[model samples]
Target: MTAAEGQSGTTGAREDERPALLRMRAITKTFPGVRALENVDLDVRPGEIHAVCGENGAGKSTLMKVVSGVHPHGSYEGEMLFDGEPVAFRDIRASERRGVVIIHQELALVPYLSLAENIFLGNENSHRGVISWNETMRRAGELLRRVGLPDPPRTRVADIGVGRQQLVEIAKALSKHVRLLVLDEPTAALNDEDSRNLLELIKQLRDEGITCILISHKLNEIRRVADRVTVLRDGRTIETLTVRENPGDEPQLSEERIIRGMVGRDLDQRFPSRSRYEGADAGELALRVTGWTVRHPIDQQRRVVEDASLTVRRGEIVGLAGLMGAGRTELAMSLFGRSYGRYEAGSVHVSGEEVTTRTVTDAVSHGIAYVTEDRKTYGLNLIDSINRNVSLPSLSSLARRGVVDAHAERRVAERFRASMNIKAPTVAEHVGRLSGGNQQKVVLSKWIHADPQILILDEPTRGIDVGAKFEIYTVIDQLAARGKAVLFISSELPELLGMCDRIYTMAAGRVTGEIDRADATQESLMRRMTVDRS
Candidate 1:
């Protein structure tokens, strides 16, 4: 079929008046016992940003895999057309040959390699069998400039921050001459400033006539750059809504509308409402840290957390708010068994008793549980079963003479699975097979089973969808209601404002300010977060 013929058939009454650059019809993918996608249809026009929105298990990534050739042709039932021509890709390289490239949430770059080398690792600048270093550096420099990364091509990727690493991933994609760029949760790990810069770069790419497929849980970001959004629910395409007609046009999409299609229900509230706890009326202090100082583990001369002090009262959810590199995670990690850095000086008190938490075991024994921000890395063991992961922290309780009671462990896991609403057929299932939201629940269940009087949760709802976020919020509220002092740390200011009783802001390794819920606003928190008292 000719390009013009395909255009005439697909561009009927569309505002953009452009033919679909990519089209999929009757896509169906299935795992051993799971139907991941069922008759999922998607269309993308040239030079437009198309966003795919869905919950954690709604098959967003799976659909992208199908497009990117991660799931090779004939392994699934689908018909895909690129540039008005039927295409069947056998591997990622085959997709890349057609200028179709995908960047996953976890960046695929060699840490030890230089920027230029990483950018052209597989698609090297070479003549015959010899690699031309000069040509690679020259092209890498150009690509970096296009992505707004100021770092030199010779710089190692490991030396840079995550935001810069993301840019490098894009530069690598550019090296492949990517026409249809698929980004899965591109800004999930980025700070607000970095996220804005990345979004601006994406807009610039769209202007340069490069089509993009953005898979993100963040609704605001989708509304910002997407021309149209496709919502998938339970592995099926619910509807595709027009966000805007053109790049500079006013958006006609509401978050509520997109969310309704994703979850199949109207979510009246994003954050679950909790009972207010005022001063003096709040319960006794469950956790207190004073004069806490931590030096960087690698650089002993540098301080990551400096003289920080905070308190969390029983039944109260106190928020720790900060920008990236503001020492929020440093402080939490330092307090919890001094896990992160070298504790220079600090005093920890639990329920009016000064305690030493110099080790993880000591911290757990003292009734302090820390739920790490990186659930996949530090929180849960993905290879283990749900029951094993849930009972990990409290193994001693389920053990007799050092032999674990398997029946007791299963009972405990089952209780948490039911209470936390973990969507799994059995606790014997490996945690790796579960979605992001369910994996987070297992992490929480592990920590909660330890029966800690104080819980330090860091970025508990980072990458999950809005519906899953609401469920996580409900769980945190329940923990507080049970008189557990909660120290909630998050990058999102609105979340802290909604869920916290009091918020403490950090800047450059120091606590800058603290405010009550009634008095805190995004502006106030940001001001404190930017104002380094050093």
Candidate 2:
């Protein structure tokens, strides 16, 4: 049977009528000087997809950590029950032994290992203290097929894309014979098609009698698949709403209702108005690229970006839209000091003057700054204080007589902390302790401090919630109001439509089309984005 048919067949009864498969009561978790969760409660029924909705720092992850034993039993104050019996899990292994598995936002698979090895890393198929390779591969192949991954079991995990890697994570969970699967932001980094497939898999698992606890910021996806939603705000349970209505009935929950519960206020407008900047005379040409071409860094012969050209005017927010492998990130990274690929041909102009960006220093010197897509890896140092990270790109300006000036650095960080509304208590706080939204703010502050004329933001709001996205949108508008050229790259088409003055679509390493904001639609942009010139 098809996935949709299976889902429909499983929706005959209200899942709420069933007894709870897992439950938590009055859960309170704390850290040094931070109350992460307080009096939070949750419930999940068997054979249902339960969604957890919350803004960043709303204690969603903390609650899941408590349930999955990442926080352990003695680390917090809570009452938990699984299968009608009280349980205290000391670690992840203990939880897994009870058929409870959690897949974190940051995938835990080893990149260098084969898919089979990574899937069976801890729970190996063995007998007499020896592993059977043939048995392992056979079981791994069955699990992969179950998850719809066609790659060979011997394929290296690193060789596959993130969408397939997510499937592998589910396969790994299945290997443990998981009963309760908790996925935190599973589709946060996925493309539209991959996301749909993953959600279908979640439903398929539900039809097969596995319970799923889904934590996500995408309300639309929740509306699509979730049987019920539990909203958390400020580390407290707000309300639980039924999302799955009777068969052939209208939805009982709306996106606005979920937003209200999440933020404690109505978000009448998701994207802030940029009417003030609309219809204004075009400013000077700030950045221009012509006939840009780049080859794969390792292969040297395969072209990643080919004959691409675009321009951004001062005080304008232009967008780049494309699919996952459409070469949008490659073009942006290549322009930012040839960071991703070998530059074969290109000419860059700043304010109509030709310049060369051969290195990161050169790019910065030419008033260019790029906010990387993978922030945890390339944007900020997690262990460092927010003050240090905010001043990293502009350390030279804060130095006096070849010595770093501590006072100047503090002032800069403090200014950004207040202006950007970073939620940290002090600049001395480690960035790793902050929420996804706050960490993104720190990255923006670092580049804004460099005083760049042109900014390329890649997936700036990738993992943040709606409230935080609005804040980031306001910041971007403010940057454009200050006469800075902003090139926004995002996978969400609605975001591009709302925030950009114009958008350029890329497909197969080539520029497919450019459309003014007045004329752009998701359908039109998608048509261009799928034009595979290669």
lDDT by residue (tens digit), candidate 1, 310-406: 9999999999998878888889888888898898998999999999999999999999999988787789888999999999998999999999999
> Per-residue alpha-carbon lDDT of model 2 for 337-444, expressed as tens digits?
989879999899999999999999899999999998778878999999999999998898999998889998999999999998898878999998898888999999
Global local distance difference test of model 1: 0.88
lDDT of 1 at 521: 94
How far does residue 240 in candidate 1 sit from its true spot (Å)?
A: 0.7
Compared with the true structure, model 2 gives a TM-score of 0.93
Clashes of each: 0, 0
**Looking at model 1, which ten-residue stretch has the lowest summed lDDT?**
1-10
Instruction: State TM-scores per candidate.
Output: 0.92, 0.93
* Candidate 1 backbone collisions, by pair: none
Tell me the spans in candidate 2 whose CA falls farther than 4 Å from its real position: 1-17, 148-151, 161-163, 246-250, 275-282
